[model samples]
Target: MGALEGRVAVVTGGTKGLGLKITEAFVAEGARVVVGARGGAGADGALAHLDGRAVFRQTDVRDPASVRALMEAAADRFGGVDVLMANAGLSRPGPAAGLAGADWAQVVDTNLNGLFHCVQAAVPYLERSGNGRIVTMSSALGSRPAPGASAYCATKAAVEMFSKVIALELAPKGIVVNCLAPGFVDEGMGRLLKQNQAVWSTYAPKVALGRMGTGREIAEAAVYLAGDAGAYVNGHVLEVNGGLAW
Candidate 1:
């Protein structure tokens, strides 16, 4: 049997990018997943491959009610939620001086505030699961600080701190909280960054492995944290970077 066999999981922004990979990994490990997304062609298309192991729930993580409904859907469909992948996020790339207010709000609301909503909404169900796991997504940039990614970096850093604090608070309840800090992955925003010649040239040589990390690699880290291997690992930020130096 797979590590996640018999577990029920909810993944926010799960229909695409790294979130999609995590969802797919969890499902492959025998978890029944409820994928939460904002609803789009990409979301629907990506979910088609999961067969019936995963259900798509239109979720705006910024809205607590939407997140609550998503958790409830998992319980109604798969019994109870054992894992919460609070991974929904966005990037508004621009210099701090030139960043637009809308862009800032969009980044903070979806990246930081939205994750809080998901965690709060899922806690009740997760608490009942006995060995619940909450994995929040952050990025290498959370600690690295790039020129045009102030909002994204700040929100991610906040998420890491949030995860640490909550990990302690929720440990007694049998829920283990952790954060995944991926570095220069070849998916989602990182894919766009890699396609830019100037950016790629600047960042590629900095990785100790001399390459970008893959989505599957990050998914494996998620599986490790969510599965039995991570039962004793709490309040940890598992950096899945390819040994980044700069």
Candidate 2:
């Protein structure tokens, strides 16, 4: 049997990029996943290959009600949630000196506040599951510095610290909360960076492995964190950055 056989997972931003890959991996491992995105069509398109193991939900992670609905839908469809992948995020790249106020707000709202909304909505249900797991997304830049990504980096950094604090608070409640900090990944924002020759050239050699990590690699880490293998792991930030050096 698969590691996550008969498990139920809720993954936000699950319609594309890293989130989509994680959803696919979960389904492959025999988990029923509720995929959430702001656009219904995107959600539907992303997980169309999962057969009956996954469902699409219209969700705006920034809204607590929408996030709550997502968790409730998972329970109504496939029983209570065992895993919560708070992966919804966006980046508005610009230098801090000239960044637009709107861009900053959008990044902070979706990356930080949105994660809080999902966690708050999922906690009660997770508690009832008896073995709850939360995997929040962060970036290598969360701790490192990047010139044009101040807002994104700041929100991600905040997420790391938030995950640690919450992990401590929820450990006694039987919920394992951890953070996934990826660096130079080959999907989502990382994909966009690779398309820029100037950026990719600068970052490629920094990875000790000398290449970008794939979405599947990150997904595997997610599985470890959410599965029985991670039973004793909590309040940790697992970095899947291929050993990036300064």
Candidate 3:
């Protein structure tokens, strides 16, 4: 049997990019997944091959009600929620001094506040599962600052600390909370950043692996955390950055 056989997982932003890869990984481990995103635009095209193992729900993680409905949908459909992948996030690149207030707010609202909403909404269902797992997405940049990624860095850093605090608070209820900090993977925002050779050149050598990480690599780390292998791990940030020097 698969490691996560009979488990139900809710993956925010699972319609595309890295989130989609994690969804696929969870499903491969025999978990039914509820994919929550702002819209179903990418759902049908991206998740059609999952053969009903993955379902999509309209969700705006920044809104508590939407997040709550997402968690409820998972329970109503799959019996109960066993895992929550709080992976909805965005970045508005600009220096702190010149960044627009709206841009900063947008990043903060989606990356940090949205995660909080999902966690709060999923807690009850997770508690009911007895062996609940929460994997919050962070970034290598959370601890390593970049020239024009102030908002992204700050929010991700906050995410790490937030995960740690909740791990403590939620342990008594049998819920495991952890953070997944990915380095420069060749997908999503990382892909966009790599398009600019000028920028990529500056950051390439810092990675000890000498190459960008794959989406599947990060997804596998998530699987390890959400499965029985991670039963004893809590309040820890798993960095899948291929040994980033900076």
Error of 1 at 215 (Å): 0.6
Local accuracy by lDDT, each model:
0.93, 0.92, 0.95
lDDT of 3 by residue, 24-128 (tens): 999999999999999777677799999999999999998999999999899999999999999999999988999999999999999999999999999999999
Comparison by lDDT, 1 against 2, better one: 1
Candidate 2's C-alpha runs over 4 A off are none
Model 3: worst 10 consecutive residues (lDDT sum): 39-48
Tens digit per residue, CA lDDT, model 2, 1-246: 887898999999888999998998999888999998897865676677889799999999989898899999999999899999999999999899999999999999999999999999999999999999999999998999889999999999999999999999998889999999988889987898899999799889899999999999999999999899988999999999999996
Query: Candidate 3, after superposition: displacement of residue 7 in Å?
Result: 0.3
- Report how far off residue 175 is in candidate 2 (Å): 0.3
Better of 1 and 3 by TM-score: 3
Better of 2 and 3 by lDDT: 3
Across residues 150-229, which tens digit of lDDT does each residue of candidate 1 receive? 99999999999999999999999999999999998989988998999897998899999999999999999999999989
Task: Give the TM-scores of the predictions, in the order they appear.
Answer: 0.98, 0.98, 0.99
Clashing pairs in 1: none
Off by over 4 Å in 1: none
Predict model 1's lDDT versus the native. 0.93
Model 2 RMSD in Å is: 0.8
Which parts of model 3 are misplaced by more than 4 Å? none
